[model samples]
Target: MKELVEVLAKALVDHPEEVRVNEVVKDRSIVYELSVAPEDMGKIIGKQGRIAKALRTVVNSAAAKEKKRVTIEIL
Candidate 1:
């Protein structure tokens, strides 16, 4: 999951080297905090946050089979 978000964010950002993903495990779920270069924020979020929403949806569905909760936070 961490790698997945890292790859996705790196692909969208101008400063791929600045992209970072922090994973936090809590009880039965996982949370991913993704931070990218300030200049690349808009690209990651996209128009009307469509890209962010899609990213979340993809992560959610992928984690469903494992019966675990997953969330993506862009900062």
Candidate 2:
């Protein structure tokens, strides 16, 4: 999960090396916190948060295959 977020974020950011993903696991859900260079934040988020929503949708779909609940937070 972390790797997925990292790869996706790196692909969207200008400073790919600065992309970071942190995972927090709970009993029923997983939280992925993503971070990127300040300059690349907007690129990852996209206009009006469309990109972020799409990313979250993809993550959720993947998690669904494993019967797991996952959430993505960009910070």
Put down candidate 2 lDDT per residue, 1-75, tens digits, no spaces: 778878888888789999888899988899999989999989999999999999999999888898999999898
TM-scores vs. true structure, each candidate: 0.91, 0.95
TM-score: model 2 vs. ground truth = 0.95
Measured with C-alpha atoms, the lDDT of residue 41 in candidate 1 is 93
Clashes of each: 0, 0
Q: How far out, in Å, is residue 50 in model 1?
A: 0.4
Candidate 1 residue 6 C-alpha distance from true site, Å: 0.7
Query: Runs in model 2 with CA error above 4 Å?
Result: none
Q: Could you report the Cα RMSD, in angstroms, for every candidate shown?
A: 1.0, 0.8
